[model samples]
Target: MSRLLRILFLTLLLTFTACSKDDDSEDGGTPIAGNRLSTGDSARDFLSDENFDELVIEVVYVEGYRPTDAALNNLVQFIEERCHKSAGVELNVRSFPSPNIAEFNIQQVDSIEKVMRSQYNLGDKMALYVSFLDGKFEDDSDDSVVLGAAYRNTSFVIFEETLHRFSDGINEPDRFLLESTVFRHEFAHLLGLVNLGTEMQTDHLDTENGSHCNVESCLMNYRVESGINIPGMTSEENIPELDSQCLADLRANGGK
Candidate 1:
């Protein structure tokens, strides 16, 4: 072939290959609008094997705010027990430099996720993003501190710095216990607990407290995320579990 024709052919081949590669890994290319949906919007997908058979939890924490290994393991176990992910659940955890913000709102948290998160829903594998920040949530108040929040369908944030202040101290819960509880609770929101997305099997929604369950001992209880509730709730060796009503809702929603 002529030199000019050969050069043009090579360029065309390279361009076509790049475009094909991008189309094949569309989910990993960039954040999709579907991923930023409201919390609970993807509950059925997470709970059932209908849409996604595998679960990938992308855990990103700020420097000095990595979650305890025990807590992360607990989170995986919790997910396996509740979600029907026949392909299994996995966690990709890593840390980044602190944003240096004293407190974060949902918007700020979302922005961080956009920049730092690597996993996204791809084919039969669903992705969840969990951020452990060094600061507190902006909505935290002196009387009612926030521990974590599930802001998007597959995203949540844990105020790890605030959790450290409340745990592993005199008369306080163990750090792993507190972290595990918050992790499960926030993840339950993604599963649509307490009428968030999955329909409630019973009227156990704590209407006075947003999408939380009314059962005081339930993991989805509104107080579970409050600093005041930690000491009292963690008196037992085991962290809180979803109440029967909540479990019923999960079963109805295609969960195991």
Candidate 2:
């Protein structure tokens, strides 16, 4: 069927292309992920620790092009609960408005630099992009883009699609879990991790040593498409404790 073909197409594209997303509300949003962006070979400059107090997150919800409300709420709660229960990091999230998402592209790093020039000097503290990146996979991998260059040193932006390829369409709980899972997946990236890459490489998954992320009950696994669900409900149990550096950042600065 065409739908089956579409899913296959999307899977292939996503394996190669990074994606992004945004919610449509003022008080909430979700984080999404795409391909690794090469901000040239240069390392990013992070704000000094003294500047942590000035780091203000300004979320630009790119609505029209993605699933706006329901999906994002699930993402927000998942991150909040997971971070609090697992790492004790309390993230402060706020949402703003934005133009069409289709117009944004991963290569357009300069637009992100604009956020730094604004009144809040937000570019120095936060990255801006749509909220839809809360992990919903899309049939069209190119439909969205995220901008993180300005805050690349301290943070990154993920733009995800609205529709989940496997949400079972209208089943509410399944949909919620779909978004939540992706939200966790993408946010994990903010902490800096890498994937195994491609279907062929999946055999590298270490199921017995508890070393590979592909474990069914681990927060870091991405094999849900095969019905491998991580065991716990709350993130604290599902995910292991944060590494020292991440925990230090979470404890000291609060996952900002």
Best by lDDT: 1
Regions of candidate 1 where Cα sits further than 4 Å from its true position: 1-31, 226-236
Candidate 2 overall lDDT versus native? 0.32
TM-scores of all predicted structures: 0.85, 0.41
Score candidate 2 by TM-score against the native.
0.41
User: What tens-digit string does per-residue lDDT give for candidate 2 at 77-136?
Assistant: 544432332322223344444533444443343244334222122222333222333323
Off by over 4 Å in 2: 2-56, 65-105, 108-174, 194-212, 225-256
Candidate 1, residue 246: Cα displacement in angstroms equals: 0.2
Best by TM-score: 1
